[model samples]
Target chain A: MLLLSRHLDQAPNYRADVQHFLFGREFRAEDLPFSEKLIRAHVKNGFISLRPGIMPLNENIFDLLGIRKKWLCARCGNRDQEAFAFCSCARCGKKCVYCRHCLNMGIVRSCTQLVTWQGPEPGFDRAFLDGRPLCKWDGVLSNEQQAAATAMKRTLAARESFLMWAVTGSGKTEIMYPAIEGQLRQGHHVALATPRTDVVRELLPRLRAAFPDVPISGLYGGSEEENLRAPLVISTAHQLIRYAGRFDCVFIDEVDAFPFHFDPMLEYAVHKAAKPGTPFAYLSATPPSELKNRFLSGSLKGVKLARRYHGHPLPIPRFRWIGSWQKLVQRGKLPSVLHEWLKNKMEAQQQVFVFVPSVSTAAALTELLQRNGFSRSAGVHSEDPLRHQKVADFRSGKLRLLVTTTILERGVTIANVQVGVVGADDPIFDEAALVQISGRVGRSAAYPNGDVVFFHNGKTLSMVRAVRHMVQMNQEGDR
Target chain B: MERCLFCGEMRGDPLSFHNLFSPEYAPGFCLSCREQLVPIDPRHCCRLCGRDLSRLDRNRVTEGTCSDCVKWANSGRNGLYVNNHALYHYNPFLKEMINQFKFRGDVRLADGFAAELTRAYRRIVHNCVREQSGILKRKPSFLLVPVPLSSERLLERGFNQADVLARQIGAPIVQALVRVRDEAKQSKKNRAERMRLRATPFQLNEKAAVSLSGHKILLIDDIYTTGATMRLAAEALAPARPDSIRSLTLIHG
Candidate 1:
């Protein structure tokens, strides 16, 4: 009813109506978001049921013009007829066709109506800046970071997408703070998204501390934060698939990360989330070749921060010949060379991460390491229920080392930890993964240098390419 | 041309000539997604329930039977039905497929399992006909009873998966039972609670009651989890005094 809409508008903050009646769209009875008791009350009072479970309440004649009648994903603009599949929704006791493209987030059935506010928009007050100074990070940005931030802000003002080709540990998050604050001061919404949830976790505290006065919300799977309108939203890239033209400025951190680099659907989601013609700045340590070519041709805007914020060179991984590690593993013994290396690291009290190609190998290495008198080590993979706890225990100095699969290859940082990849020749351990593993080292300024070793049975092109890429980054840092 | 019945994807080798030599070959699904349907390893399974025994703790098994079956035997309901035979594991993939088949009214999916069910039917019931006739027989004097759904559920879901499966098994299907009450879906309940609820929801159809006497009955269903539904159905059918009762399920959770 119009009275209900008015009551909602009078509230302290705007509440996005997740369920409302829309004209011209065929919706099922069961997909209604409200409880049956509430629907019963509305029905009793005079609301007409269009069908068994569908309500055809009159709101505005113009609202019907914007209603999408056909089966299409309002969030991701996915119209591929084959992308939809029939699902028997428990809530709506009918055979509902759902969008399979974004099924990982949650099912969005075709017969289900995703209705937001159709009333007049609310105006946000200047109370967010009520005599409080903006851009409140106590730590000052480095000269390189400041220059990159200026360039990024300029491109945002021009309404053009730009690439921020910053190396690992280059303070990319801090560099975006100025642009976020500028956008917020102008009453424009801004979003910071990364492809990995761990990175979102690491960024939340830093962003909150940097802008303590502003209202910020973090969106990720299982996050308990309220999902209301906010000036600054920090989320994982997958969460952006649900948003629709809500942001004026978007920053896609780790643009080249897994499930986002080669995934065209995620890229389409990024575009769908941003307002038309709005700017997006892609920040990645290793930009994909497509983006790099566009930057080279001057078709896309670009900025680069070559050096680490701590003024140290990126660690170059050196290869070591360890013949038939799998054979030695089957015998319950490590390679002689690797055994000596582990002994020296343990003797020096160095925390380490031993990367393997698969979960089984990680378990095998963990067993072998423990058998070799390294009882404080543990193995972890994606399916491990205690994965987060193990990482925390390792960070708190309770564990001396960890044997992990590629799940931990990116978005994890431990201080003063040496890195080693057991099967560098495996196809799963690609050049991007190797580069990310090396980036895990030399992360903290307290220990700006560490060793990265690729203990391989034989060399592969990916291994050579990773080594060369790291060396090239270091060379550029010197300039 | 054979195609994957799940997503309608075309199989790479639609006609594997080697299949001609292998009687077990059934080109039902494409290789790209065929791994989703995980077959149960008969070697490492509970002798009584056909559940994958590898997942159970070593101390939980006694005399080649899982703890659930041991509990069932202790409850004095062991003779209600013969051992249940399941074809696949009730994994997430199978759960989704079954959900689409039953709740979503995708009746065409039942055709995908026609060959396998026919094979199981011949191995279980047809062998008896062969022993009596001294030759491969075309028909057996056995009643195929599909687990009945309540009238309300029949209206909601539009079809019963067990009926479809039994029809595909190529035997004479007999709707000899009816549900007196519309119990909530077993999927919404926990395993322990589902097993403990000893209520029988079925009653013998009066018209088919006389024929059930002295006839072997084979119960058909989609999944065998905790064995509560089939046990209750068998208990309900005991009044007719069938000679024997058995069950065949598509998946074992």
Candidate 2:
């Protein structure tokens, strides 16, 4: 066991205080905040020992607080037995079963002791943050934006959960600033969590500029801001697995986004990370139906911002028939109309986003486009390591077109860019994804409107509903 | 009903629980993921080291032995290990799997390779029974001894990869050796440095040595990289005076 301690010490950034590691929830030894020796001593003294290696200090306190068995993981929420395995754990030195569902995040074994903060509440000095305006956003908001912001501030003050069902391009990020400011003024820690890393990258610069005086940090995998214990944290939802009862308020951006919307464990993590009775808000252009139902049934308080931040209607997607796109691409050609559309967009100096269904298709289409004299065009997919640099090139106008997968469907904003879904009817492009893709076209106030085309082999209900949904929102915006 | 042990993705073609557990029916991975796993063809392997020799010219193997084995034979250390059998070529897929098993602490991955390993052990046991003649005829008895991990490495990895592999053989296992000192991981060292790493980290466990007195030993490991560890281990076991020792590894580099 002592030999194991030396190995535990080898963990990078390992701290020595069990309290820091265990606070807010239980933790595996691999993610320890304190020295393994200290934790082992605690376990030896019966202060903590659950499954085997999992040690939570002060078990009696957890019992008193009614902390139940965390059978379901707080990250990715995988409760299936298939996603778990029994192993001879070195930490516990016993046969222990660990959750494999969220293993990629870190091991979550049955005996893995999660630590929660049991001591006096962590409070920041309000005076330290005084004299300076908490929010530095000097621009005035539109009526709907102002209303949503006020409601957000009120919800934070009341410490109640709320939802902002804002449409795409409705300045959802800006709307949360006032509420975030209110929380910061009260010296409360705030977390702005989103589902994707790209959003985290996009929000970090904007948030840093908005609250320069505030110690703000962005949390994501491979993020440099990880070590910063800032009062305000902008993080991807996946990064929230390490936190426990740490935030006073958690604002989840794009609650309907992939992995977060689908994985229950992310929701569990949100509950675990936020302090008890803390305020939270779900900000999404197209929230999941369950959340919508909750809001409709008066179980949730929410606001709707239908119009774009630039006060223009969302660019409604126009469907163009292109029969058997798979066959066309396989035949080394594009649909005549779509090819003409791409040529026109390129001729007019407009950057284009051509969303394909898969990586191979993206490559094939990019090859076809390049061969057809569109030399500045390239394909970008999730597996493409150069996707970031390619996106940067597209943004700087060095590249005229980017053929991509759904990875770029959301949270990408390029001014004067025409958007096209080559396989709009493909099941992968759900209503939410289509809405997000269209939202990308008319984001910038300078170029508030651009063409959004859905070139498909056949019409599908999702496509029709997406078109109807956008036009309906545009009509609602008129009010 | 069957799912990938790693990713939890359900197999498109459902497998019964019995079939799922059976090595012949399921390889413990989904079809897409299984593409990464390339089994070493036995016909294409070196006689001594079990290294894939298909890429080498037939002339390179003199008298059914690779140049490495010939060198060891010439060095008079061929008796250090009777024969080494390995199941896989050390490919990137196996490397990633080993990473999960040894480094990431996902110990259940041991079960994924267990069935096939046990089958291989049984075949070796059968071979031993057939060649029960001369000095080998002293006993049909055998002891399974997994190469011991240093105390520090053991503490870090929690469980030894070789030990886990040996356990899957379903043979009686003994902790016959204790590591006297920890050395840098072999993977981190350059080839020359690894070749020069001659100091034996192992010492015979006196208590367990009594059990190994006259028995044939089946040394087990996760990978047969430089073959230096096995040489040192055999030298360390010389005191116990085991009649003979053979090694079985999950992979051969």
Candidate 3:
């Protein structure tokens, strides 16, 4: 009887530890540190809930229609039938379905139980919310930036979604500082998510410097720092799939970038990561049509800043016809027109960015340039193991001409770098992508104007639209 | 509407009478992903090890067998074990696929290789029937015995990769062997060290020994590197009096 009383007394301590680890996260039951008996007791006491990792989509439908059955992954919100496969499970000793989409995170099989905390919310240390200024950024925001930042703060404080429809190089990251600071001042967790890893890498250092005393965690594919309880999380959207109802305010930068716009699973991840009724701040140069339409109809509150932080108009691209460049590249010769343009840039001692449509093109072009006396040129792509080192070399002027694919089109800022697009008419370079590629030039105030040339084999509608988009934005900046 | 299991692109299979009339199978991979896999050509492979002979050096090949098989034959370790038949070359692409399947614990990737494994198993059965003409007039029925991992290793990897591959053959499996010693991974050992290692890590399962009498055993595994593992496993099964032992693997590195 005495031992039973002591065990009962220790129950609250175990429950508190479980609550602390699982308060705002969804984890596989096997991943939890506690024993099965403890977890079961907590589940029975209404302090935690258990759910199947993968569930059948249509349990009530009969098999007479000859339709294939589908399953859903509760963790990643994956409903694609192809992403699920059946195997004889080792743990359950039965045929079980597992989600292949998020397999890298962990194998989520049908028998796998997902655990989440359901009891009263755990208390957090609110000592940081002493009402001092959190953002230490001393740089002044331009008039347009100031106006948009103020509007963002107001809408978020009212618990409403806000979009910053700003152009590239328009101080988008700086404008987010005030809003993020407001959330952190209230001891609320904030997450700044982007679709691309390059953007996350670029924002981590800037955000860390702006708020030096705050603990921040930057998450990407192979990032080693995994402080889940950090108040500020800067992560790629893919990493947010592991979190659940953790953030009070979520900021999505580059809202229409790749994978996020192409794959609905990432959108589901961001939605699942934030608490219910959490406000979202979207910052984008070229917003997708759905968000654009909502903002235009006045159903969603947003502000459009056409002007860049430097108060200069966007660089308009010039088109040049280069016939059959692929054949010339295969023949180990550079296009005559492109050769002359590169020669001019090199003679003026300016760095250049030559963007190709595919990885193979980047390699072949880099070799062709090197054989023709441009020894300082190099190529980089997403799969290159030395991608970070190569980009660093380019920034430090170790490589004068950087040959790259679309992976370098965003989140890179180099002063006075001239941009060249090889095969710009390819379908890969859509209007939004072309605009972002052109935005790479003239990013710094010291070199506020640079050349952007689109060398194409034939004119494409996307090219025309991209040019028009820039022209319209420049006109808006003038007004 | 079918998509590649690896790349997520449309399979885009060309329309043909063979595809339209035949019962459809689940899509494995798209054309590009399929093209990356290099199958071993039977005409140009080492007769014993089933390794692609074209990539081997001229001096390494004596008649039809590679140097490694000659070394194995000279060791006198092939008690009742026959030669191994490998389906594919261990190129970087297959290595990456296997890494994802084995180390990363993505067991679903085994589905992509189901058709290839089934076809290879049928070819092995046909060869066995042809070789043992008088001893086995009819096609021989074989039992699959996947190479076993130590208990600790099994718990760490969640599932045995050989067991997953063996299930694709649709053959009856018998757990007749258990690993007695947990050695370091075979991939980490040098060729000389692997060949010099004398002690066998496997032992016959006493409970399943009765079922193995007079049965033709085909040991299944993901890769056949030095052939030492197969010989050790065959030696372990000698106590059960199996009729014969041969091996099948996905790749011969």
Error of 1 at B130 (Å): 4.8
Q: Is candidate 1 or candidate 2 better by lDDT?
A: 2
Ranking by lDDT: 3, 2, 1
What fraction of the reference structure's interface contacts does model 1 contain? 0.00
Error of 1 at B157 (Å): 6.9
- Model 1 lDDT tens row, A225-314: 544556688988777765655688999988888878656667777776777888888888888888989998999998877789998999
Error of 1 at B206 (Å): 11
TM-score of chain A of 1: 0.82
Write model 3 residue lDDT over B138-186, tens digit each, in one string.
8889899999999878866668899999998999998889997999999
lDDT for model 2, on a 0 to 1 scale? 0.79
Pairs that collide, model 3: none
Candidate that beats the other on TM-score, 1 or 2, i.e. the better one: 2
Clashing pairs in 1: A29-A53
lDDT of 2 by residue, B1-253 (tens): 2667665687665557867677655436667766676666766777777778875688888766787777766666545478888888777877888787777777777777877788878877777888876654532666899999888788666678788888888888988988888888888987677656377889999999999987889899988876778878888998898988888988888
- Computed on C-alpha atoms, the DockQ of candidate 1 is 0.14
lDDT of each: 0.76, 0.79, 0.89
Best by lDDT: 3
